[model samples]
Target: MHPHSPDESPAPRPAGSPRSIDPRRLRADDLRYLLAVSRTGRLVTAADALGVDHTTVSRRVAALEKSIGLRLIERGPDGWTLTEIGRAISDSARVIEEAIDRVVDTVEGQDSLSLHGTVRVSAPDGFGTAFATPALVRVRRHHPQLQVELITATRQLALRPSGFDLAVVIGVPAGSRLVTEHLTDYTLGLYACDDYLAKYGRPKSLAELREHPLIFYIESMLQVGDLDIERHLPGMTPAFSSTNVFAQLEATQQGAGIGVLPAFLTQRTQLRRLLPDEIDIRLPITLAVRREAVTHAAVRALWAALRQEVAERADELLLE
Candidate 1:
């Protein structure tokens, strides 16, 4: 984060002498330091973010501008602002910084446990809303500077550069470039409201489940085909279908029909698990990150936090 700066600017190329721009003058450390200053707009704040002194940040910026032969930034009473050329250069530098960081992570494993900056996570809507969100909140409490972005979607997300920093998925990833690990296994069982059971009667066995209507996922919209509960129960059909688990859960609660629900999501509701002994369905949850991010400090910390939290709450998550 910190790079030595020269107090004096380098002597300008002699007038009319061919001014050669040596690419070597633009160092990765210098670019990263400038990128930090550009983001924070203040030397002290940028220094704090990079864990360096303000003077080091200022000197590095000055040195970068000198070596590049362009004024990359301007500082005044209004705070720091990048020049027209500075903006373009800084933007390019940011990309290089990211690539360099990834390379560094690839070479040296996770180096720090201190979580900072932002980590974007993608997960299934149900788990992201009911489970991962709360767990990430706890992680934020431990590292106040860490920011977590949880994107919940019905479809499986891609694990690659420009995608989510981390993904918690229900099944396996398609590509080999992603680093995936089994997080935990959760249980899903047939559940229905007490009112519904009283009115329609609970199924006594898997074979009897056909007598009652089913509330389940829409076949065409299912992100993971295995989640189509009726596939596990032969000759069964859905009387009510939805792509959203929450909607299906709500309908099931209103005495609509029996629905397969994650056990943790139903714990606080009045729904009763039906034929638990016969209909215990387990789904393995996997945590995936781009291979390049396996050694990233912030990503590693976030991954560790999620794994620890999920494991600690296995009873609630896995229905043990």
Candidate 2:
């Protein structure tokens, strides 16, 4: 008798042989192609990023659109414009990318000491340089193996479903999809250098501040939150407007004006509090992270460390 062959004998079907392949299923390459196109805005550029020929990109994109039964891109004189569905797909692809990163990190043991990757953090330029940078120093003392990339900009960096691992944002996060953790409560207090205080004396009341050269953060230049300075100090207007808190702080140090600074960033400075007994302007500081990125052990550890640091230093942070 001939040797039994597995393929020669018909095996019973598992009762699902006629099931059709889902037409809407998206492949990794499809998302990669779509995201590349969105980023580069040209088929040739996208193809370069993907290390493929322009024709390959075109063909694959056509295949993806056909598979999904939607026209994703509209070619026009303005180059390539994404259709409504294209924009939606690009957004969804970003979420998938983050989730994939988390999965890879998990599989690679992100919590292990061998875990080494750069965690990008976005923060306001002034706060990042003066305050958050020091906090990173403390974090490094504990986890020397880890690396952090701090992007300090006056404007909010492009974040969320596209870029950045975490962002230290002021005030409550708007979107429900984001994972926001309360970092600390910030209390804005009027402060001036010792010399300034000596020259002008401390402002005992809101009216007293009018005589002092009042420095304030210019509302138009702020990136993170609303400038509610008027709410805190009724009828109070500034003599000097600055786009940066650190600039205002420096100006206050030189006796230029009374500056309103977050207590956390000002505690170590030579600047003395004005009207310490009766002034209070507190806002909640929250750390916002993309929900999909939270599953990565490195991201989780960094976030946990940040929250713990904030909590540990809450009293100092709040100036309570």
User: Could you estimate the TM-score for every candidate?
Assistant: 0.65, 0.64
For model 2, residues 1-320, the per-residue Cα lDDT tens digits are 11113332323334745434354565766777776665444677677766899877777777676566556766644356456677677757765655665576588766434334445676766557755777776766666656676776544423223335677877776664467777777787888888877776777776777777778877666655545566677677788888777778788888897888878778778888878767777877668785545654556776776776666667876776
True-structure RMSD, every candidate = 11.3, 11.6
Model 1 shows how many backbone clashes? 0
- lDDT string for model 1 (66-132, tens) is 7877677765443565666765676577557556655665666643344556566788888888777
Tell me which residue pairs clash in candidate 2.
Answer: none
| Prediction 2 TM-score vs. true | 0.64
By summed lDDT, the worst window of 10 consecutive residues in model 1 runs over: 1-10
Clashing residue pairs, backbone N/CA/C < 3 A, model 1:
none
* lDDT of the structure predicted as candidate 1: 0.74
Regions more than 4 Å wrong, model 1: 1-114, 159-162
